[model samples]
Target: MTELIAATGSPSWDMSRTREMVRARWGDKALEALRPVLRAVTTRLIHARIHFQDYQRLVSEHLRQPLEAGTPWWELMWVDEEKGIGASNYFFIAAEGYVYAGVQAQHAIADNLAHVLYYSLGWNVDQRIPLGKVSLGTVCAQLARETTNSPELAPIQQALDALSTAPAYQALADVTNHIKHHGGLPVRVGWGTSEQTPFEVLLSAFSRKQQTQPPREIAAFLEETYDAMSRAVVTTGLALNEWLESSVAPAPPDNSLHQDSTPGGQELHPTDQPARV
Candidate 1:
C-alpha cells in the first residue's frame, strides 16, 4: 500500500504509519506544527497532478477532434454556437494553460520540500531559513549538512540529489524561471501530419539562452518533468518516513529554533507565524 500510494504521486510522508511513528516519538506538538506545511505540500502536488492529467486529456481530445476533412489545419478555430463567437486555437490555448500551471506547481513542490525538510528536523521557527525563496538546490545543500554527521540521513540526501541533478529538473526550472523573470517562451500549437496520421502538436523552445533552438514537443517535455517531480516527491517522502520511524525515540535537536528570532522579537516558526514566501 505504501509503494502504491507513493507510485500514485502522493506524498509518502502522509502515510498513517509514518504519522503514528512521528507522533509516538516527536510528541503531538510536532504533528500539530507540521500539519499545515504537509498539507501545503500535498496541495501543490494535487495541482501538479491535475494539470498533468488535464493536459494529457486535452492532447488526446485534440487528436480526436481534428479539423474537418480537407479543412486547413492552420485554420484552427472554436465556434461557440450560443455566443456565435469563433475563437482561434482555443483548444491548444487551454491545453497550454494547463502546461504552464503544471510546470508552476511542479517547481513549487521543489520549493515546498525545503519547508518540509526544515520542519521535519524539529525547527519550528527560524528567521534564517527562507520559506518561499528556498529552492531545490537549497534543500539539497541543507540535506548535505544534515547527512554529514548523521549518516542515517544519507537516503534523504540521495533522494534530493537525484532530483536536483536530473536534466529534466534543470530544463523545467529554466523554463519556469524564464517565464517568471524574463518572458514566456515561444510556443507553437497546431496540427501536423506524419506517415501514420494527423495529430496535434504543442512545441516550445525550452532553451533559455537560445530562442532559435528547435522546438521540442511540449507534451513530452511536460511528461518528463511530471515524472521526475513525482518520483522525487515519492522518494523524498519514503526517505522521510524511514527517518521518522528510526529517529523517533530521540527527538532531533531544534538547531534553528532557539538560535534565531523574527524582527518582532518572536521566534520564527512557520506554524506559529507566517514565513514570507
Candidate 2:
C-alpha cells in the first residue's frame, strides 16, 4: 500500500509518475511554475545543513574548556576562530541567516503552492488563492474542504490533515514566523571564564552560583529547521502529486467540483514513518 507521508517526514517519490500526472491533470505549466519555487527553497535547505554542522563544531570547541576566572577562555578567540568570541558570534549570525532563509522559503512555498492549486481547480491564473497571513493548518483545511465528498480527493485531504496536525510542521511554521516577525532566534551570548573580571566572579561568590557561565550551545535548532524544510519539499510534493493523480484517474463526473473551498477540520497528529532526504 502507498503510504501517505507526514509533512516534514521525507519519503521516496516517484518522479516520473508525479510529473506525468501533474502535466496531464494540472497542465505542463502548473508543474513548471511550482518546480522553481520548490527548487529555490529546497536548494537553500540542502546547503544550510553544511553551515549548521560547521557552526555546531565551532561552538563545541569553546564548550570543552572550563570557565575559570583566570583561564584564557574566549580571550583566545582572535588566534582561534572556532572557540573565539568573534568567530562564535559570526557563525551564529551565519546560522541565523540560514534559518531565516528557510522561513522565507516556506512563505514562498505556501504562496506558490496556492497559486498552482487554485489554477488547477479551474480558477483563473489572475485569481489567486489567498494564503498570506494564514497558518499552514488554515491552508490545509481550505484544501481539504474543497475536496469533501469526493473519495478521489481523500488522499489529498488526508495529506492536508496530516500537515495540519503534525507538530513538526506547526513548529516549523512557528519558528519561521518568530524569526521573520520577531527579529530572529535568540542565540544568547556565552561569557568566557578567562574574560570574566574579578568583580564578576565576586558577585557569583556572593550569590553561591555554580551557573557562572552560559550553557554550552550548538546551532541545533537551525539544523532542525534545515531538516524540516528539506522534508517539507518531498511531503508537500507527494500531496500535490497524489491529488493530481486522483483527478486524472477519475471520470469527469467524479472530478467535478461540487463544493466551495472552506476551512474546517480537526487536525490529527500523524504517526511516524520512514524518513528520506
Clashing pairs in 2: 77-84
**Which lDDT tens digits does candidate 2 get at residues 239-271?**
666766656855332213322121211121122
Deviation in Å, model 1, residue 214 alpha carbon: 4.7
The residue pairs that clash in candidate 1, if any, are 125-268, 125-269, 126-268
Best by TM-score: 1
lDDT of 1 by residue, 194-217 (tens): 635465465565556764445667
Model 2 segments more than 4 A misplaced: 1-11, 57-92, 102-138, 189-219, 223-233, 249-277
Q: Against the hidden true structure, what lDDT does model 2 obtain?
A: 0.45
Lowest summed-lDDT stretch of 10 residues in model 2?
Answer: 199-208
